[model samples]
Target: MAVRKIEHVGVMVSNMEASIAFYRDVLGLELQGTIGHPDEAIKLAFMGAPGANETQVELVEGYNGGLPAEGKVHHIAFTVDDLESEIARIEKLGVTFIDPAITTLPNGARYRFFYGPDGEWLELFEPPAK
Candidate 1:
């Protein structure tokens, strides 16, 4: 059976309010809604792109169990037409970023990673060269 596109990417964060503010105010993502799961002891929010596209970032809060550095997802990269401008906009949010966009493969795609709300790693990538 063929697989469809990704529905969402779930991330566990310590703080939900801070995460929501960053994604909504800083990153400019549209806030869909947040639901609290008492059984799971967690709260989640889904953010949509400007075009009403699929939920890109799934903000999960109250996961006090913590995550391991190894065997854990490193970061999430969102594609953009102008990587530099996006980087600048995100920087204004007061988060630190690992920069110096580089090219490794022959295709030479540039990318950079920045900190999201609650210090979650987030990436921004430029479109592949055509």
Candidate 2:
């Protein structure tokens, strides 16, 4: 009950540059910053939509990137303004889609699955408009 909200989701990545580009350029998330772990030799990067008090995406590098067949994190979903436009844009960027088509929820929300640069499952969710 004391938890305010989901702060961030950390994703393990092999190549920081590629992963950063995918999340920032392809996914439209602004790169807040990147730094080398002081205690460890790992690298860390944080990104999120500007001015949006939403869950942040943290990309971890130099850690264990040996992900399982399904990847480390099950999936991370990003709220999008336009599902159709995002799908088309992602396709144009040649990102691999895990789901063949967008799925509509009973409440009218729509979503589609796609893979990130590190094979992490990512989702684009568009809730029904008010």
Judging by TM-score against the true structure, name the best candidate: 2
Whole-model lDDT, model 2: 0.75
**lDDT top scorer:** 2
The worst-scoring run of ten residues by lDDT in candidate 1 lies at 1-10
> Per-prediction TM-score, please?
0.47, 0.51
lDDT per residue as tens, model 2, 1-130:
1223454577888888999999988899989866554436587787989877578887878767687855645467777778888888878989999978887754466778899998877778776678
| Residue pairs in clash, model 2 | none
* lDDT (C-alpha, whole model) for all candidates: 0.64, 0.75
Task: Give the Cα error of residue 68 in candidate 2, in Å.
Answer: 1.4
In model 1, the clashing pairs are none
Q: For model 1, how does the per-residue alpha-carbon lDDT over 14-89 read when each residue is reduced to its tens digit?
A: 6778888888898888888665544367676778787776547778776543687552344576666676777677
Q: Which residue segments of model 1 deviate by more than 4 Å?
A: 38-40, 68-130
